[model samples]
Target: MFHSVCQVPTAKVCGDGKPSRRGRSFIYRLKDEDQVPQQVCKLFFLSTLGYHPTNDSLVLSVMGKDISTPLAPPKDQRGRHAPANKLDQKPLHEHIESFHPSVSHYRREHAPWRRYLPSDISMKLMYADYIEKDNKCSYESYRKAVKSLNISFTQLGEEQCESCLLQEQHVKADHQGEAAVNCPQCEKWQIHKDSATGSRLHYQSDAERDLPEDTSTRSVDLQKVIMLSRMPGVKSAVFTRRIVAYHETFVSVGKKTNKKNTISVVWHEGIAGRSAAEITSAYAAALEKERDIKHIVYWVDNCSSQNKNWCLFSSLVSIVNSQTISTEDITLKFFHPGHTFMSADSFHHGVEQEMKSRPGGVVFGCSRIV
Candidate 1:
């Protein structure tokens, strides 16, 4: 009977390894009273895109050979006692165990994805599941059971970050509305044909005209760092300190830090350094020891006073002309007004988290850790 059901076109594996609409007959030779397992029937039916079979339905089907003898009915339609078999004599637990194959080993084999989940997140999931189960299982009990099983989970779950969520929403909105899509620039430096043609009107060297000849490689190495906006003010008792942080995220390739990588800070009495001189003073002090760097490009927001003024530019120019250090050129790249999120933002977030964890929500005044 099982062989009869598998006569569909999908039951055959085609030469191209795809399901073809070519019907094929399946014949299974069996001796008298021989039985076929339920797993075989399930795998066979599911292969043909058929619905999965339940245990009760499969047991009562005429197609399957029953493993156990006929069980006596507790009460027939006429209330007569039916003949009993050895299968009816066992307990309810035994019957359930026989009907459902043990999935303990299978579940164990498939639980590797849980390792990427942090313990706290796993505990939260377990707690939620326990609550949803009407509090039948305690969290402590479930935790103990999991610990006894000796499972190791070390990876993070597939959760979206705020930036990713925002990007998704932006894409969806751009599609739905008439707003122009802010597509990511494919090339770092793109020179339009009109701009290039205009620049050729005057006979000048590409270097003299300040036109980028080779966008791929301008110097020996092009390492871009970040200089973020002023972070949250840290307050303690009577004194509040402003925190300025910097991060060299692209200094080395393939090396990543899970924590904040910020350095070189100035702690003023107020929230932050507002004046251009104070900001440049802190910046100069931070670069006092560094001498081997070739090009220092600071990606900062378009702030007029603190970072973008002539004072800061003149300070950098004077430092380059002094020849007191090995640094050659300094460039300040201003980010767009509303879209200036960088590694510095993440670093500031880490700092805020650390500060919140502290007593009285206070981070003491200090310079950026080297």
Candidate 2:
């Protein structure tokens, strides 16, 4: 039955202008002269082979094959030899891995798993270095390998010292002169940078010190003003005016035990502005909670209108003099204007992350942030 259904009857070409290839080639008929319609023939052929009628081309190909020829086994290429031009990735990967010694690793104090490379060391520079070593790999392959390793570059902080910025500008200006060797601006810039570095080291030393049980170190900073009415995935929300909310974070660290306690005071712009009076009030409230400690050291930024003003000082004096407060000594250490990245900033970062992860990213009121 299968042979009868798939039989291809051939006929010689009879009428031709010349004895070309087409004239000599055998012409095969798809069906017998009295067979069923082409569609029904296809359906019958497919049904016998357990194939759908939609595969008419396949059915035609099979039916058109000469029955005189025997079927040959398919040539399997599995387990064949690898291509000669295929690259050996082991050496290239080792070269890329060698970059580990050149770059510094920094782990986030809050999230230890979140490691980062220095901001200055970019992929382009690393790839350039790799090429200098005569490594044989494309930049794209190197980038994929780095990405697979979960290596990421650290972003620059939001705040930078104004003094450092000015000094940089001055140094650039001094370099254009004929005698750039002994420029006073270069000396001054170096002094400013040294001062900033010293202050940061001193703050770190104080924070890491193991002190008496009666003393505690606290780092305080005002977070960036958060805008409310943030609705994610809403196009119109971008144009609307948002309410501003102020957050003051105080991270109290136990010098001896290395324990941390974070306190956040949140308020909207309608309640009070970020004036010295408001800041002093917040500081007093934070201090009120630490009355049990005999000595408290505060690390703050050098913002005269906020932490460095006489208003905050007078307020602190009043708190210390008040009989209700048990604090015997209060010390306020100010970090350099542009280099105040402290524990409070980390706390604010955590708060920002939490706010972003809220359902629908909808923040209607200031209380929602709390």
Counting clashing residue pairs in each candidate, in order, gives 5, 1
Q: All candidates: CA RMSD in angstroms?
A: 20.7, 16.1
* Window of ten residues with lowest summed lDDT in model 2: 101-110
Candidate 1 lDDT over residue span 1-370, tens digit each: 4443422223566788887664533232333345643323444554444446433254235333332434333345663556552222223223222322222211222453332234354555655654574544455655554544443333212222344345446556755532233454212112232333343222122113332211111111111222233234633522543344322222111113222123434343344444677667656754553445565555555557656789988998898778686777766655433334333443444444555565344342224433
lDDT of 2 by residue, 1-370 (tens): 2343444333443365443332122222234478743433545656666777566565345444545665444569876998876767777667656666222111232344543455567889988888888777788887887776666664324555566667656656766533245878767767776787798789879877787777878888888788886787787887888888888877864354765456667788989989999988888877777778898889998888888899999989989989978999899998766767777766676667667779355332222222
| CA lDDT of each prediction against the hidden true structure | 0.41, 0.68
lDDT of 2 at 136: 70
Off by over 4 Å in 1: 1-261, 270-273, 360-370
